[model samples]
Target: MTGRPNDWLLRQLPYGMLSEDFFVRFVSIFQEQAGTLLQHADNLPYLADVDVTPPAMVRHMGEWLGMPGIDTSYPAATQRRILRTAAQTLQWRGTVRGLTHLLELYSGGPVHVTESGGVYREGAAPDDPAWAVLEVDSTGPLSESDFLALVLDEVPAHVQVEVRVAGRTVWPVLAEEGEMAS
Candidate 1:
């Protein structure tokens, strides 16, 4: 299925079959439908591609990826950008790197994720709960509150995080009906 079609009819057809008029006509009709189906099959991967997928289908892809903060209000371009990094986001869901990657896709700028309680050692005493510092430029497509919500979703619930946007520290926001993030 991954390789080229190498059936005998396609690879080494007999000359006698080519000369039969009825055979040729019947096969031509069959080939027309088969070719169309084959072409669709060949392009099936493009449907999954965030860059080339149709705008209407991109939202469905978001659902398949289980990417949070997706909404119909966000522009198709923003949705694509978020979907493009869904794999990386899912892969690093709970760590600093995962949160950083997802925000970077939205901000298109440098995102800093620094945490203070991750050093491990043998027989070392367990430290108090960890805290994370998330810093990003707020001049991106995402509004500040929406951006913060995404950060909360990616971060572990037990870990306390402080977000600073454009150099101003942001306390936790209790947004009504959590807003959408790109």
Candidate 2:
């Protein structure tokens, strides 16, 4: 019969030598333990199919699935948030909102996106090149190169992207005065 190892072991036992009460008790205990194991096995597929939105499952199974936004480099809470929102953000892919969200996620700050040529003015042609400018105001610890890489990874190939860092001070215009005051 198709059954667990415990069932086969019980079948091979010398049942004739055992008292009826002893045999019944032993079989009952074996079934109880084996049934629990079988139930867990049955749930394995459901667990595997669970989405990454659950923080516990993301922490446990993320590496096996290579899930996005579950990087260990980020803080635990950030990783959980990223996993929770990954699917939602992916739905907006190729849009300005998506890029802005991605930049915010990677930089841990606010992002502003400005687009050009995508909208049709009254008489404008539809073929105009679309471009976007991303302004990031971040005081987080991400380096410039890492921030750029993260932004670039999310941007669509068809859209040109310009990145500008906010709050930087530009050099003051020179005057005939010997020194410039801040």
Candidate 3:
């Protein structure tokens, strides 16, 4: 005959259990583990919801959205803000409004974005077309090349840009290596 492990144990159990009988024993263990597993499963859907999602998960969400210059060193709130507005930024991508918004978010400061398109003047326009200029404070996380590539990815391929970081201008597409993929 097989002897039960708890045969010699007392009938009553701790933590709200009535008894350590077969029915209660298996159910208690399964119940505890299952509740925890279910909680984790339920949270899977919320991982994409930036405001409520875990801080560490925010980076992965941003990456999944294909946003550039989401620096790992950035604070959790900043990461959340970036991830949250990624869709809005994507909607306005390539426009001056979009570029300015993106750069401001990245720098956590004001940005000036001036593009050459849509200008209507009475006199003849200059023979040489002027590229867009993005002026931002230089205190952000991205290196100059990375920032340049990020901007390039936003604009049309035909449009080149000049970036002035903290009043220092890097003229006419500073991507010595290459532009970052959009």
Model 3 residue runs over 4 Å out of place are 1-23, 119-130, 173-182
Estimate the overall C-alpha local distance difference test score of candidate 2. Answer: 0.63
Mind giving the per-residue lDDT tens digits that candidate 2 earns over 88-172? 5777777888777767776677888788845566777566577777777772557776666666667777776667777542222
- The digit string of per-residue lDDT tens for model 3 on 1-182 reads 12323322323346455544676767667666755666688678886787888877887777777764467787888888888777678878778888888888777689987777766686777666656888998637777887777777877676767778889976564355776423
* Clashing residue pairs, backbone N/CA/C < 3 A, model 2: none
Candidate 1 ranges with C-alpha deviation above 4 Å: 1-45, 73-75, 119-125, 173-182
Highest-scoring model, TM-score: 3
Q: lDDT per prediction?
A: 0.74, 0.63, 0.72
Query: Relative to the unseen true structure, what is the C-alpha lDDT of residue 48 in candidate 2, on a scale of 0 to 100?
Result: 45
The better candidate by TM-score, 1 or 3, is 3
Weakest 10 consecutive residues of candidate 3 by summed lDDT: 1-10
Backbone clashes in candidate 2 total: 0
lDDT, candidate 1, equals 0.74
